[model samples]
Target: MEKTNNKHPKGLPYLFFTEMWERFGYYLILGIFVLYMIDPKDTGGLGFLDKTADDIFGTFIALTYLTPFLGGFLADRVLGYVKAIYIGGVLMAAGYIGVGLFQEMPLFYASLGLVILGNGFFKPSISTLLGNLYSEEPYKANKDAGYNIFYMGINIGALVCNFVAAYMRNKYGWGPAFITAGVGMLVGLVIFSVGMKHIRSANILKPAQEGDTKLSTVLLKVFVPAIVAGLIGWIIPGNIFGSDSTDAFIFACIPVVFFYVNLYIRANAEDKRPIGALLAIFAVSLMFWAVFKQNGTALTRWANYYTDRTAPAVLEKPLETLYLVEEKSYESKEVPIYDDQYRAEKNEAGETVKQEGKDIYFRNVTPERKAELEADPTKPVYLFNTELFQSVNPFWVIALTPVVVGFFMMLRRRGKEPSTPSKIVLGLFISALSCLVMVGAVWAGGNGLEKVSSWWLIAAYGVITVGELCLSPMGLSLVSKLSPPRLTALMMGGFFLSTSIGNKLSGVLASLWYGYEDKANFFWVNFGLLLLATGLGLSILKGLNKVMKEKGVQ
Candidate 1:
């Protein structure tokens, strides 16, 4: 209810920058995580097989999202949002630094555990705090625009961090690059501390109501059962979901899923409809993330091995000067031999087999380049860093945010703006089309027999980024609008619960990349999944709109 002429709250800019720096760190790590995992051990990587790496990547992201369930609960019931954010930020910083310093698997996993735990504490609290800030006055009507602006801040960080990660990794090696993530996180924490005065009023903690579940009971009922089920899933005789981790994750999710369902079942009459609507939206949106989150896994694989990464002649020298290009020489040495699909050849013992040959990058090169490379074997080919492609989605987000916001504003002025749920459904439909772009990429590249232009990847990311803009931030705003005041953060956790499952599924889908003989089919599957999600959203659109109208929110 504080008035300001800035058209937004005083706290918005502070939260925006705080989240920007935090995402800078998170996205930086994500941009390079899979590449690091699959790189050879000699290069200071885990040297995991692509499938194994995909599994770990999926599980790691899944756990990070999953922990928000407890984090939100604790923030709502015990710790205030500000304290939780500080704790989370420090822990994440330590984790990033630890990852840089350690190489042993156990230590590395421990470091990731720190990040997972830290993100749980950090992620939900910040968004919830921002929502609380918009709970009153003229600000209330502007929640969607506020979240859109905040989302742009997130992408600004995302867009720039990949370049920094590329420069750091290319110049200083993986350790320093990982360590830089920690530095970024610390910087974010510093910003948060500086802006604490501006935002502290928004960090209100609601007192428990009579029917509210106690934290102790939740721990006993939800956490304990989830752990037990996960353990059982892990130790089962045979794999049910293609891997122990997958099985464990799916099994663990059962209890948590049931808990959310139970929350709906037990909700008071007034709270039930809105909670139900949020849950419905959560279920449908999971498919969108299942496809979109693949930018880190399957899509990165396309950029790394399938796309033509040759720097344009005009910019090659400048890129090289900046250390933004990765150079591979045509040296005939004992390196991993890849098949047409770019899978490393493995011996019967499951170890990669190497033979004296040109690098895998040459496998799908044009005939002219192949002859030229063979004639001058010592020549190095300078190409853009594969991780640089990770920036494309964020770049699209930043470039398009203003357009999207303006378009919606125009519609709002004309009394024709779609509700948030409608936008989300439209997003799913558009995101499904991004898969078609990749399918075209597969066709254009002649089914992996040749390298495709990088433009294909860029265009695909462009389309998906549009869908992401419509859905992701809107989901956050929708939660703020519909949630019962005390349960806002908890419902936000439910949104992320959908994201966790989708992330894990993204990994599962990526792991199957090698199994697809015709890569177009892979993208087609993604398209089908999104279509299903879009249809589901449409089916429930009326009911969801009704709930929104009843709640007196758009």
Candidate 2:
């Protein structure tokens, strides 16, 4: 066996920053997507109902992840990874710019199409490229660490982009925030181009193996049928799954899911066990994503309405200049109370009825805190942008990645590092534990009858981030490790397909937010889903561990 030094490949930083900027663009838009959609049309928003917004959000993210399957296949066979990434980045940027420039239904949908397509090509290729860079001797030993580092870079973009999003949206409007997202993606593309030299070695395209499935065959058999299924779901009379988009997404997934199942069925014995292990992991991960993805929909609602967002008077004006503060007056006025669909309730006079208050925000404040604020001359409540809370998870990732990496390193040095499968098992249980933190938040907040402290959100995000570190990057590393060289990119795409399913499920779950009159019940449902995932993960642990050992991957 050849022993090599443990220093990381030079390509790491370039991939790191490129992914960071791309995520910045992606997450920035996501941070404010629902908020913008639900805002009044007079405020430059689309005035969508909350359920509708959540549905759109879910569908968008699902499609975004789903396309990576094709992307990875194309990168492996047709376009080299680097070229695919560039194409993806450019398309995504154009989509974001289009979103900012045009808000009408046609252009909006077109832009979304661009982004969905762009993400398909860009996401898997770059990740596959990064995995390839670590395939050599010394770096192979450090693939997990490299992915952890890369994951940190992704969060760095996610962390900072929300502030940018908040500032741009607050100062200019929704359009500019979206435009900024486009610019960030362009910046990412430029950075990737600059570092092309470093990553050139990893851009090798895999020719079709003797038994490998051809791209043409895949497009005709998988994608073509998926489109037909999606169309059928869309045109079907009554909505079986909440809405047309939801039905279409679920319907479309059938073919893709079948394709993966077919992959397992047709796989040779040598590759079968690892593929099965990955498929099991993928199935359980749907629950993880269903819960984790709430950061955009359900969790954002908590930040916007349930949490106390008032800033100190001393920092109010300073924060205001940066567009960090959302200033609202506490004066009495008639405001619409949202219905189950988050639409304003209308009266028999054919006009929207209103109540004698701005929002339930004040009502949720405890008596003591309310009285204290009422006595103050500062009638204008200054709130930190709700989107800013989206940073908490990424912020935790950045702050804790070093610690996580160090802990694993310590274990490695002691010759006791857990196998990748074991780590994933631990991650699932830990993630399930994080949901309990939110359960506490609900109880502490008097079941949404009172505002909770920001510490609750921080704590929840911190716990989940730990689980994310253990599981997410490890999943990437596992796919790279277990996949046969010829099928590496394709398997990477499969990993993302799992994510797509989970993302769509997340939207399905989030759309039920209004259905839970008791907010505690909502968090409990999330907790239950994660617990189910954790149990499923535990049952498969021993088998997955055996497969990893068989594959000679720790």
Candidate 3:
């Protein structure tokens, strides 16, 4: 055990800044992405008619998550974590900046590809590096605390970016915001380069196990086949699964998922059980992310188009007079008030079209305001930017972290603190409850025709942040606790793989944004999904508790 007062690795500071800036860049991009895509075609956005935007959003994030499998494998067997991080950072910066300069589809796709590939290289390796730092004798005792600290740094970067995004978008426009993301990444890369000396000890590449695929062989076997299969899937004749893109992505992911399963099977005896359990946890965790990540896509859509974000007259005067907030005309002209069910579009044959007026926000905005905004041409409505609400979750993360850490420490003193698995289960259930609050918001708004107060979003975020505080940090802690000493870094990648999947699935869920007619039904779906995942976790709780006991972690 580490001495009671031993400090964390000297490398942590370097990793912390590097990660913080990287996330700053990423969140900045994510914060504005959908907004940019869906903005008016006249103003340089894709103007992808809502459904198309959702599909692209889902596909991009999913592929973004899916690439880490290759990234992790290569780092474990070929390039050390440090080199991988550098390569990833550079690629991401280039990609982010490149996106800002182009409105055309080809450049857009290329930039996204760059970001995905960069993340594959950068995301998993850094976490592995940090895991390596804490695995040693002097810092062992403080591993969980160290990770919490690192996670906080991530939140710090995430929280601050929205403000930067807001200021850039509000003052300059969308391009600056994209360019800003790239610059943030570049800053992170510079920080990492400066700190290389402190982290070299933690950057060692592992020797492959006897059955492990050679790096070159994996490229030939897994990647080449995946590419060929994906090409065919993309080129297939019919829309087998709604879209050719979706079909291709699913096909591509199949081989990667199977490869991971094979890894668990091929693992040495000591590693097998832990791998199984991690994979299990990863499965449940996907549900959490699918719901949690909506804060950006669906939830942001709600904040933008539905929620009563109007600033009070008194508050509005200073803000507008100070030139900090924008006041846009709100005749609710975005959609017609007369169409029953607020349907925005219809087919000429009098057939009811499915895609019209399905913007996620319309479910929450009431009929009265729709008419009012449409009728009143004189009143200029000053509302807070919808992207601003994106900060709420991370804001709570910063506020609640100390309290959560304190609460757990109290339980530890009483010999009643929960195991990591138990905390995760509890977190999932609490998360379900957060969605129920949105259900209440639906009820209060009279099933979403009426605009509700901002408190609904506020309360939902508050509740979910509690769940996030419990589950997210603990997942990282569990990885550190359970990983075999020999495979610590590889397993850290595995942990992030779960996060990557969940993150992508979040996009998938968000992409389905136009599918739900009633806002309440949409939230209810989220509620049910969380409850389902929670029940699964609870069922396995006893076994997980046993595993933790075996691992000798509290």
Candidate 4:
């Protein structure tokens, strides 16, 4: 019954905070995931090769998004949104905790599977639930703004989680850091439970319509075919996409992609144009994610090895005291000798060969500091934790959301606001510019021969954040506005399916990091991908705008 200034439903703030904490848990794990995987086993990490870690990271994220296809379908027909969310939250919480408690490979994979399955049920349902809240009088016109507001909550959680993760991991080690993520998820569930009463009205379930596809048919046709194709891709492939998991994932997606196409084909006449428009948007936006999602892989690698993370003098003491800084002492000891690309030398047995060597961080250090460290080998250099860079994109999101929201409002008042599809096309172009910034960074840093300022990474994330603000929330809002009432959740899953495919491609690209002798070319490839997406989006913009207008929604 309560409301925010009587402008929105009371449930808005509840859902906002619930998502905030959930993302806190989610991003915390992501910020540390790759670092944990590649860390030496003696330091409580998985000790996997960089290629191996990138492959798993991509597969894990890809599957997380992929599962929503089933999750959303079930929420529409069987479990309902609220029940699905509860089950998902619980599963994710247990998964987070399980990851911390078990380090063996089998147990570790089992835990990740839990998190992937849990995310499937949780992600789409919550977004759909918010759309339902804004479907009625007093709130209908504000749905886009509502999604933007909701999106900021997600960024807020993402913005702050890395610092907590740094403090936890640095102070208590990796296991405790992961456990903190589990605790955050439980807190989110509590908040969601407390606001359940206020949001109950939005939980109305639409019955299956006369022409709706049967659940049995989808299981047999989509799910079964996907499973079979994935197995075939896994067993009969010879690195078609660089790894068995990548091949399996790509093969598995064919059936799901076809399912979405079939959904458009089967839609009633009234819904056909809108569904078709949405499919086009999904296809284009996949490239945006293919480049943007690199924050967890390629960008993270840049932050870890290429960026100069030295804590400034004023902040160094406090950061070290709080355990937010990593210390590396130049000790003369048996250590892995790294090549110019930072990969360790391996013997014929494929084991990393240790010899008297400096830490990899020294490779890009200034000569003066390197000499000073050599003079006092016991003295340690304090640098910010690599995981801290994960917060940059989210920080930009939180800081810029209001500015973006206000800018759109100003345009609205002038009766000149861009349509959602127009904004998305503009977003793709802007995102491509961010890639150019990194190319500049690569040149400025002498192609990783020297460390670059942290500002390069920050500036890149800032630009992409602007594009993200324009595209991501609009994509969600568009689906809600355009999808048939009975099919909203399923369509939301389609949006994420695009993101899943993009995420997998990101991993595939990142796995080729060592293959690029000229790192600038790496970023150039990203720029080209975004530019291609921009061109595709522009080509279809007018048609999509017409569809939106025909649907009587923006």
Candidate 5:
């Protein structure tokens, strides 16, 4: 047996801070995005409708996670992990700053493109670097725990960034919040640059395996074909899908998807099973992502519209002083002030929609709250900004990570813990229940005709977070465990591919937000999707757990 330290490595701290700040910035931008868009142009947002926001939101995330495929491959082949990190970090900072500084619609779109491209370079490479660092003989035993800790760093950023984003968006407006995010990224870059010495050893790039195609070969055979095919998909005469952007993204994924197919086809028999299993997991998890990704889109809307977001008088002053709360006046008739920057077209009812001049934020708000604000003559009514809802998932992740990890450890000691696959199956099942919470929230809120308590959203997230803790960290650990040593980098790419696809589907699902008039029906739809994914996962759990046990890991 190898006599290694078997504890997590010194580099874990650096990686932790690196990811913490990186996600801090990334999630900050995301948390405030919808609010910024739907806010009145007079208030500094683009003021788009919910459908438009949903479309762009879906596409933005779709690209953000999708690019990791390109990023992972580039690192595995041409650019080493450190260089990829540097490139990605710089580009992302530039993109964040670009959005903050530019108010023009074209510029905003361009800025999004930069962020998308930059993330492809940034996300997967850093994760791959962490994996590489752990693969060193001395640290191999601790890789799973190390990855979980690293995942915690991501959630910490996610949890805290919302407050930072809320404060900036409410107090200084959207630009400042975005600029703050950009600054966070720059600080992350500086830290990573300073700690270059620590990670230098793990920066080693492996030579292509004997049967593996050369970098040039992949570029020629995969990259070029993808570009050509994607271009064709983009300019096709009519929209086969709902939006041109969706068409373009799907087209773009064709070559990338094909590349993975080739990898599986070409892989040795031993490698194939794990790759096949991962690919299968990735395929099924698309539904999970589609539902889970709604945290930002549909769920955010639920918080903004259906939830009673008023801060009580006792807590209001402190929050306002901290700039965590924003004040909107009913006297000013600040009916969300949805206009050109935030307008949506209405049907015969004159409701604000994604039609162009309407802010979708008003869609789910209980009519009672609306009437109360419209009729109030007393002190100005204050509503909590919608961005605050973004904190729930990460907050849950941070609060639950240690407990979940410890419980598993305790179970391991007693030989009663579930296998990683079983845990994931459990995770899927638990996550399914979160939707039920929302279904109840819908009814509780009187079918979205009245504002419900924020507790509904809180309770739902709390449920899903446990599932997330079980599934998400464990998925990363599973990849490290099952992937063959030689093809680890490529296989990690596969794992992210699953995530990327799921992320895209999440956007696709969100785009349908405008279609569902009854919000509870919308939530139930999400629930059903997760239920299907969960059932599929459990169906395979017997086999997956068998394989995991054979791998001789907990």
Candidate 6:
């Protein structure tokens, strides 16, 4: 045990800063991504339907996570971790910049592709490199705490980015906001390069071990099949999963999932149990992410349209000074309202088409509020930026991480620390309750007919934040602890694969929001899925714990 609570390696600080800045850029773009997509094209947005935006968002995030598999594999055998990190950083920066400079659909998708590929290379490599640093003595004893600290750095970026996003998008436009994301990414790359010497020792590439799965075999078996499966999904008769994108994504995941399963099946005897434990934990954890990842989708919706955004004048002016307020002017001119697809039924020639209406947000506002707005065309309403709410979950993470880490350290000192498996189980249960908190928010809002207090969103994020602290960092620590030395990065990729699946699933669920008139039921379904995962996690605890003990990980 870390009796003296020794200082972490110098490299830890460098990794922390690199990850912090990278996430700053990432979350900044993500905070406004769907909003930008669904916003009117004339207003500097993509002009996609809400469902379409959700699908793209889900696919983007999922693919971003999915690329880590290739990244990790290449890092282990071809490119060293540091080289991979640098490449990934540059690509992501360029991708962010591309999105800002281009407005065409093809260009927009290409930018997203750049991000996905870049994230694959960057994410797992840096994480594995961090674990490598902790693998040495003294730091080994504090691996979990180190991961918690590293995780805190991620939230720091996440917390700050939304404020920047809100300000940029509010003051300038969509392009400037996206450009800022690219700038942040470049800054991150600079920091990582500057700190290269400190992390150099941990970037050593591992040669293939006897009986290891060769890259050639994996390409033929997994990559080729995944591409074929995606094609099959795209060409299938109708929408089996509500959309072609969703169908393709799910189908593509099959081979990847099977690849992971194949890992366990092919493992040598000594590695089998730990691999099994990881797989099982990965399965249950998918539910946590399915619900948690909604911060970018369904929760964003609530913040945008349902929650009360009007700030008191005193607070409003100060917030505006900080560029944290979005001001909307009331105009006297009447515009055709848009249908669900955001199309007007009548053409300029007065031809028949889809129905149209005012902006959905204004249409949903109370009649009294509408009249008050209509009374003064020149008046501006200062509302808290919806993206500002994205910071809440990360804020909670920063606030609670220290407490969670300290609590566990105290437990360890008393020889009473709960095993990682136990912590994960508790996290699953706590996460389920966060869904219920949102259910209450829907109830308080009277099924979205009226605006509700902002505290409802805050409370839900707060509850879920606690669950996240227990789960996410621990999962990283678990992989670091349990992975076979040579397979560490690959296994980390597997963990992210599970995350990719959950992110896609989150998108699927969020896309269904418009279909649910009773919003509470949507949250209730989220609650039930989490509860189910929690139960499954509980059932597997004994076995997972046993494996951890066998591996001497806890």
Residue 423, model 2: lDDT of 85
Total clashes for model 4: 0
Q: Model 2: which ten-residue window has the lowest total lDDT?
A: 341-350
Q: Is candidate 3 or candidate 6 better by lDDT?
A: 6
Clashes of 1: 0
Give the alpha carbon lDDT tens digit for every residue of 139-164 in model 5: 78777778778888898899889888
Candidate 1, which ten residues in sequence have the lowest lDDT sum? 343-352
Return whichever of 2 and 5 wins on TM-score.
2
191-280 per-residue lDDT for model 1 (tens digits): 888888778989999877875667887798888999999999999999999999999999998998999999999999999999999999
**What TM-score, over all chains together, does every model reach?**
0.93, 0.92, 0.85, 0.93, 0.88, 0.90
The backbone clash count of each candidate, in order, is 0, 0, 5, 0, 15, 6
True-structure RMSD for candidate 2 = 3.2
Q: Which is the winner by lDDT between candidate 3 and candidate 5?
A: 3
lDDT at 16, model 3: 96
Most lDDT-accurate candidate: 1
* Candidate with the larger lDDT of 3 and 4: 4
**Model 4 lDDT vs. the true structure?**
0.87
- Predicted candidate 2 versus true structure: per-residue lDDT over 1-554, tens digit per residue: 12335478888888999999999999998999988877766558776767888999999999998888888788778889998998999999999998888978899989989999999899878888888898887788888678778877888899999999988988889999999999999998888888888889998887567867678887998899999999999999999999999999989989988988998999899999989999998888878888899899989988988888888789898888876667665666777666533355544432455678656567678888788767973677878889999999988988988898899999999999999878887788788777788889889987877889999999999998898888887888899889877666567767888889899888889999888877778888888888888888889999999998888879
Instruction: Sum up the clashes in candidate 3.
Output: 5
The lDDT ranking, best first, is 1, 4, 2, 6, 3, 5
> Poorest 10 consecutive residues of model 6 by lDDT?
348-357
Per-model lDDT = 0.89, 0.85, 0.77, 0.87, 0.76, 0.83
Residue-by-residue lDDT tens digits, candidate 6, 1-554: 22234668778888998999899989988899988877766567766777878888988898888888887788878998999998999899989988988988799889988988999889888888998888777778887678778888898999999989888887888898988988888888887778777778888777667857677876888878999999999999999998998999899989988988998998999999999999998998888888899999999988888887877878877788787576566653445455542233344333323333343456556667888878885776788888899999989888887788799899999999999989988998898898888888888767867777899999999898888878987887799899898677668778888899999999999999987878899999999998999899888899999999898788
Question: What is the C-alpha local distance difference test score of candidate 1?
Answer: 0.89
- Model 1 residue runs over 4 Å out of place are 1-12, 132-146, 268-270, 345-352, 371-377
TM-score of 5: 0.88
Q: Check candidate 3 and list the clashing pairs.
A: 331-373, 365-449, 366-449, 366-450, 366-451
